[model samples]
Target: MFKFLGYLFLMGYILIPASMAQNHVFVEAESFDNKGGWVIDQQSFAVMQSSYLMAHGMGEPVSDASTTVQFPKAGTYQMWVRTKDWAPYPKGPGQFQMSIDGKPLPTVYGASGNDEWKWYKGERITVKQLQVKLAIQDLTGFNGRCDAILFTESTDFTPPNTLDELTAFRKKQLKLSDQPMEAGHFDLVVVGGGIAGTTAAISGSRLGLKVALIQNRPVLGGNNSSEVRVHLMGDIDKNHYPKLGRIVRELDNGDPGNGNPNAKEYGDARKIAIVKAEKNISLFLNTHVYRLEKQQDIITAVIGRDIATNQEIRFTGSFFSDCTGDGTLGYLAGADFRMGRESQAETGESLASTKADDFTLGTSNLWASTPRDSVSTFPRLPWALQFSDEYHIDEPQSDWQWETGFGNYNTITQAEQIRDHNLRAIYGNWSYLKNNKAEKYAKHKLAWVAYIGGKRESRRILGDHILNQMDVQEGKFYKDGTVTATWTIDLHFPDKKNSQYFEGQEFFAGTKHIRVAPYTIPYRCLYSRNIQNLFMAGRNISTTHVAFGSTRVMRTCGMMGEVVGMAAYVAKKHNTTPRGVYQDYLSDLLVLVKDEPTPQP
Candidate 1:
């Protein structure tokens, strides 16, 4: 990960303790099928490291997951294990325990699930040179993947004095810290780690801003994750926006290689790998930002908490960007923003509410099932439509899915209903498979459901100009446009029956009979109305509900991030606020964004 020539003499520079003989070993283990030595389906995998960690379930969940790994030579040895959260509910972080000589360590749970491939460290402990054992546990109370077991001692180690060399050496290290022991004070702070947040962090850091990407969870790619489990429906083509995420393209394990054929899990592993390699990005994976300190519209410092340690920490940034889907930081910083639908009289949106509805479409917990693939019946919700094989597919090879939206209720209450609706949708499909005798898939069960909630609507930061559907329909182009949306004015309502209750028009499903072409979205929607020197991106951008529905798509959102990042860079260069770039230098901003060869993004 170091720059060119940064690796020279790096290996010998920082000498770390290693085994007396300086020996190394490799081991390979699969899910709990210890049939002979570590093997998958009885086939051996070439060992790359000295650990044959097992998932312990043949990739299935074991009723009791505690397993013991005998330590070879226990002199303050460090052990590494990886596992997936295979639970009915999505996996939260879990814990692992160490038992030496049948006695548990002082701590009940040793390490949580946050330590996946990115999680590494060295141990500082004194152990009698005797064989010992470690018992690992999943405190997260979920069942999933666990493997890549590694064990090593002080004698077998190396250190690098140079930052580049140190980063290179950290690839396999595993350890943990509780409080704000890690460094703080970043040059730029990205307040969300979703797609926009992730890109902003990486891009900003690559631009030489010591950036701290504050994400809610361990992984990046907000909606497109095992947690949210939503397929990214954005433009992957460069014709739309300059290929800002080619790195992401390289990382994606496309449809050809996904574990679940039914689940379209395409990921930009390249981008992820790059982000992980960035030294400037101090990724606080399992951390959340709490509050902020602002002086006259400028964020002086921000406060946050490491979820595990419950420790309060403060960080300061000369420049900050709000990528939080909810725009949490912008709202707190007294940013002027609008949420829900603005009245038609306000933004001139066709579907704008006469009276704004505070209740947005809300987030949904998504579920995906293959055509003909069904499982045992789940109890159907009262509102779920009954299946009579009414919906049909003529093509035999086409694999399709149904995404049913749980209508808005109380945000919290409707969330449960939405989840239940997803479950019901799964069961209803399953019922059709078994009882209805669908010949294609009578064997497929509920394949996967999103662990994190799939959000459709939330608080939108009120920007200087709340882009509306009318403007989009009229093709209100801005030379300084930051986002371009071609998708139609697609909207969804609760049910046909509840349509009248809504202040705005209902969302039509499937039919974009009047699908709109790509229109340039304005730059005003990227900053707050109330605060100065603040920027906003992603689904939370200031737009009337009707306009937001179309612009909220990830592709457009990604473009929004890229444009915003370029604008930020311009602002940084000019030493002005985001609006400053949008205004006086807008023509220049567009030229900068389009002309600058995208960083090795």
Candidate 2:
């Protein structure tokens, strides 16, 4: 028996390495020690000698570096890590990277562990050849190490033989599909069109790329477009949030990103100005990305379905980013995400419920009108789902009846139906004058149902950290934080009519005063927990629902877009990923935003 145990232990160290996709062993160094490559985090390093796993420290270096590894074979694989620190050193919980033969592995971070040398193992790593090099780094600047490894053989894993492989890997990891996208072989692909997408694509194109923007709408400005009909709302670079929404400034009438425009009836001339300014970025309007295509975890292409043409398209890129307000691209692509409110118990907000989930406040199709010559008698909405006599208004000038079909059907589809419904509702509501038989209801016709609808109240992409109301109320300042949200938790509850669509028993959305100053939005919220090379913007960033309600505002979302854009730029410059910016290259990101608040709008 003793001899058998010895043989097994020796086999653990000597058996030929399998070509599996797993991170059993990781590098403990930053740069490549040999072969111009480094291995980072796999799974857990089996704590053979202790009860706990190895750990790294913040601002502390683990210098016991080993790069050259005697591997038996090679293949595609992902590194899994069970790492932690003594109360995440204010800055973070870093990651362990794996680089083999000059190829780097996607380092997944945001794990919690303790002081013991716990056992961690890598997923099945796929190896193709023998004897490759590896290196690792403490991404959070924390002190830690990797131990055990699985090193199994994997089939789904695609080996990174070339840069095309890298791009393909990233695209697959980001959930970008096989469909062709407008941005082909571009240096950068800005995912969301709305204002951010447009600006980012233009900016990146200017910086040089076949910049392509994947906008889900026929036109741009997403919620502010003629499709949704919701008015443009938000203030630019004011005192509190401090007008940092540069995208708004450059567009939106060049108003410095702070003007509150009720309507851009001038055919979004300002928006058109910005769009026409860029000759580089090809706008893929009416395009929707369903999946990501890539090898390993790096993004390569965004698979999309064009609404107008109803054709599948693929947009490949050197670097891909998401600016979609709902973050649909990132979510379907295997990015880490979260939803709903963090109960008051979790986030310590007075309005938060006690439970947590992936729920969020929905969009609103707003209507704008001025007082007409006379009052139009409203029809008795007999077929109206929530219409009632008690709901009748006497001197109704501005009515918020958008609560009609909310939560009735799918939200993604709701935009299409409700947009038309709102118009019909307006005309039909006005038609009540002919039916009500009241003189007060004279010849007042419908004005407008807004050009866009307010979409996505609280969609949070689960990141390394969840920005909660407490973080805002407490004015939490984080060294690892990249952006900030300055709005209040403005949630809207379901009307008393239909309770089915309501996410929680308690609905929230009402904040008039800006009680809190600027709250730091963490860096972790920008990327995914599982897939690497993916970045997020808009309301889908990781945050409590209540916090999301506040940050989901247009101006704030735009800032998030700019931050992610700048971060991507930084990552590209550094030849790393989004997570890389938060770890070792944070200063580079902050330097971009360090300028004075310059909202040109």
Candidate 3:
């Protein structure tokens, strides 16, 4: 048959036969056209569902990555890899080692095994050359990771070890593209470029819509960006959205200290020059999304991926918004959320916990330190986490409670073991303040830390109003109010002396706050009751969990992303859905949340 369809289209295979398949090959370690210094970590796409390539090298040993692979029907394969032994001790401090057309193998592979992401294997090569290379050496510059490289030549095939069957066996053995790559059509997509998705993509591109603004971190301030430095707390222009936070004061990085190394204050090129000066916005940035496509209850698109060209784009929208803060494209479009703490008789809230629980709150990784004029050495971590002395904390910085996972963990399936237990509580409290507070941090050092985990709670989604804590302590005035929230219920916890030294795993943190009286919020707690067009501003809106401690700050989630980008520009000028802008365009979402006259001219 035309020479077996030209050797199955030159071995990239379609339905087998490049001399009959050979079971698996896969590859993709950032398609390594020489990824030497490694480091592509697309922050655990909802927990190791993709984007990897690590070898971080923080403790030093880097530069090796390599890549090339080709072989179609070679002889003895077996490889394996996928990685993550990230400190499973017995000898695991993120080790590495592998190579192939460049020799070196003796199975070093990551290091024992404990942080829960398997695969490993190795050795058994013999390809008889059809293009080879491979590489990836790193023996502890600390991070390690890898995520992809299968090989196999049937020793019972193997592969698929869950994460939805290894993301559908890497989308059908890396043939990928189940139709994605579009990334355009908009009208208002806005999936987290944070400050409540870049003020809902600059208020749905100044009410004209056609937005997009994805942002899987390249910065646009989710956790006030400067890579999670957080600082843009409450109050902004006042309730019922007074010109809804004037696009969050045109992207404020105004620096109020949250990881300041002599304060450059996260301007992030003035929020990417105000979302590239919004000509009907488009943004994207590192992309991410994961997948979505719904129909019965809306959602229609959302694919993403591009963590440095892993391609797959697909956006499409006519009003979407999940401002990701873990609502992750509204939990991949099945929506209907709510996680942790609810029952004081089911959200009469008053500091909940009379039943419903999973505890919520507790993420921060924040750090900073400076002083250097001389002496600075630090490096005796022994795979961290061992603090003593009444739970030591001699801080040089980090105010956001250097937090860790939380009571029952599972912050989106234990976000990389809660950002590696806040990097082993900031390198075991800066190596116990450089071996017992060297004359009060002698020369300080450790400049900045946030390995991005500023998160504060997850999944709220369920909307059409969930707002609780007695509707912000009885202020309640709904008419679809739309963001004012101010911050006071605060929350957090796990710091009873670091929860008596890591019991249930604590990493500092403590807060209760309570204060009150600022209110407003509503727009039915920002869209989606059954995913009928998602929407939702930061801290995953729809509140509860003590009204997401006063609508989880970031300028009250940037005025609920300027009232869901003015109700997704009145749901694309009335084709409708975000609860049809409060049931048939409630006075055009109250004149786009009274950006001018909710009263007082």
Candidate 4:
């Protein structure tokens, strides 16, 4: 007896019987009522099919995530948990247990010896009540994860293992619709909530445009948010465009050095407050844009799925901006993009490699520890990457240098692997220091470890003019030069000492900074070359690998967003495309840039 209720759009999940089919019940880990220390990880949702809950305690066990579920009937039911042993070589460090009504389950999860996500069957237990409390208890606190839990009565029932099969199964079970509900049309729809996207939305709103700022994560400021903890970099309002960086300054909550243990220093609330204050801006957090509708060369709308509930929302707009660091939106719309470094011959930059390769700047999962008054104990991790005195990084806390996924890994496809690799390195090194050098770090305890990896370089969306290294070094200025990038052309490679030990999967990074004068990026580099109605900012902006080193910083990226927003306003005012703004309304844009007003909250 199923009674249908109207679809709840905001909640993202359909109102269905908690017990589907009277014999089976599906519960998403991310939808837990009290998540405790567990974090929602959606980085691999595109591949894995759903966002899961992760216990990232560094070493110590974190608090349990608890929730209540309603069973169809109080009878014998078999339980299944979808999870993976992140490191299954010897044994997984990410170990955890599930409990019902405070009673522990017989089987331990996350150490099933399977490297991929699969369903782990649990003992059949008789349910004593229809509504019962459930909890996920962490064992090792070394990044254990749980995707979803299923309770079924059928003995032969097995959850789908394949991605396609699992996707269909989830839709069928959850009763999700094929069509997406419309999220109001806007003048400009920004697809990222980083410093660049946040600034772009604010800029467009201030310039009299209805803007929709959609961020995949719950918080704004991608890396600078409390989740990642990277400080804002690059000089703001330096030389060319004096009034460009005012919006960025509003969101800057002092430089909380990379991977700071104090979360408040990163200023998540301040950014949220400022964005919410904008009357013309509609902020959609925790919504990831996976697909888009492109008519001919113009993008008309984007389809985003809720990270937690899987509800898809369609955002229609006149113009769109690809601020996703990985160029996700642009790639979905079939825009031209480059992933790795360009060859010396291709870019004519001396810093470019001899030949084109997959070598790109790595991602960082920074961690920090504090010295406790009392001596602390850490478990020896045999399953983690072993580290010796000669090979170990003897540091109190990890910074931007603690990075992975350079030449050997794909930053987008293998992102979870990259993050897991960093976790292994972090835990392994910490274990070594705690065991071997106990006298020095006897009282040290891990305070914070980032679950969300801070990425440097990924897909660079191709635009009208690709910014190059020589352009920055030789002070090549454009008439349409809007945002001035002042950071040095700093490029990172695997550390020689670390490479000797870890080889291809080197975790430590070494960078050489080539000094450059303040160079203004051309307006042509802000929008896609072929994709009409498309604008891009952040690390994905059109740039050679060498030039990206200079423009990839947050402040510089934010300035690019400011320019994009201004251009969007002009384009909307004249009913022209992004390119048409530069070609036809160049003077109009320059006038706005020269006389930019102070942004109000």
List TM-scores for all candidates, in order. Answer: 0.62, 0.60, 0.38, 0.95
Best by lDDT: 4
lDDT of all predictions? 0.52, 0.51, 0.74, 0.88
Residue 348 lDDT (model 3) = 64
Q: lDDT tens digits, residues 1-601, model 2? A: 3245334423432322222223222222221232122123211111121111223221233443334544434555554443343223232233555455666566443344343323344444556665665544445333244432323244343334243553444234223345342334666777777765665565445434456677665467765554444443445555233534666566554321211224454235566557656666565655557667787767788776543222446777767777776566666666666545566777777767767644445545454334477655443333222222433223323333353332443344334344333433333344454355355545543343442445664345666677777787888878866556666666665555324432332121333444567677777777766667777777677777767667776666666666666666777888887787788899877766665222212
TM-score head-to-head 2 vs 4, winner: 4
Against the true structure, candidate 3 reaches a TM-score of 0.38
Candidate 1 local lDDT, 1-601, one digit each (tens): 2232123213211211111222221112232222221112110111111112222221123333233333345456554333322122222222334344455544332133332222233243445744333343323222223343445564644333343543333322321122333345776777877777776676666655677777656567776544564554545463334655443343344433212334336453544666778776766554466568899878877766533222335678767778878777886788766655567787665676787666466454444444443344333222223355554222222121222332344333233334434433444444444456545444444445443456666668887787877777888776656565777776654444323432232221232324676677788888777777677778888888888778876656766766666676777778878788777778767775566434444
Pairs that collide, model 3:
187-210, 221-225, 343-346
| Candidate 4 residue lDDT tens string, 1-601 | 0011113543444333233654788888887777889989999876776788999887778899988888878898899999999998677978999998999987898887788989999889788888878899999878999988889999999988899998887777666677877777999999999999999999999988999999999899999999999999999858587888988899999888999999999999999999999988888888889888989999999988778767778889999999999999889889999989899999999889899998899999999999899999888888778899777888898889999988788888888999999988998899899999998899999898899989999999998899998898998988999999899998899999999998887999999999888999999999998899999989999999999999999999998888888999999999999999989999998887888844434
Which order, best to worst by lDDT? 4, 3, 1, 2
Tell me the lDDT of model 2 at 382: 32
Cα deviation at 582, candidate 4, in Å, is 1.4
Model 4 compared with the native: what TM-score? 0.95
lDDT of 3 by residue, 112-214 (tens): 7566777877777889877777788887677777777778777766677777888776767655567855756787788878788888778778766778788
Q: By summed lDDT, which 10 consecutive residues of candidate 1 come out lowest?
A: 41-50
lDDT score at residue 596, model 2, on the 0-100 scale: 29
Instruction: Arrange candidates by TM-score, descending.
Output: 4, 1, 2, 3
lDDT of 2 at 415: 43
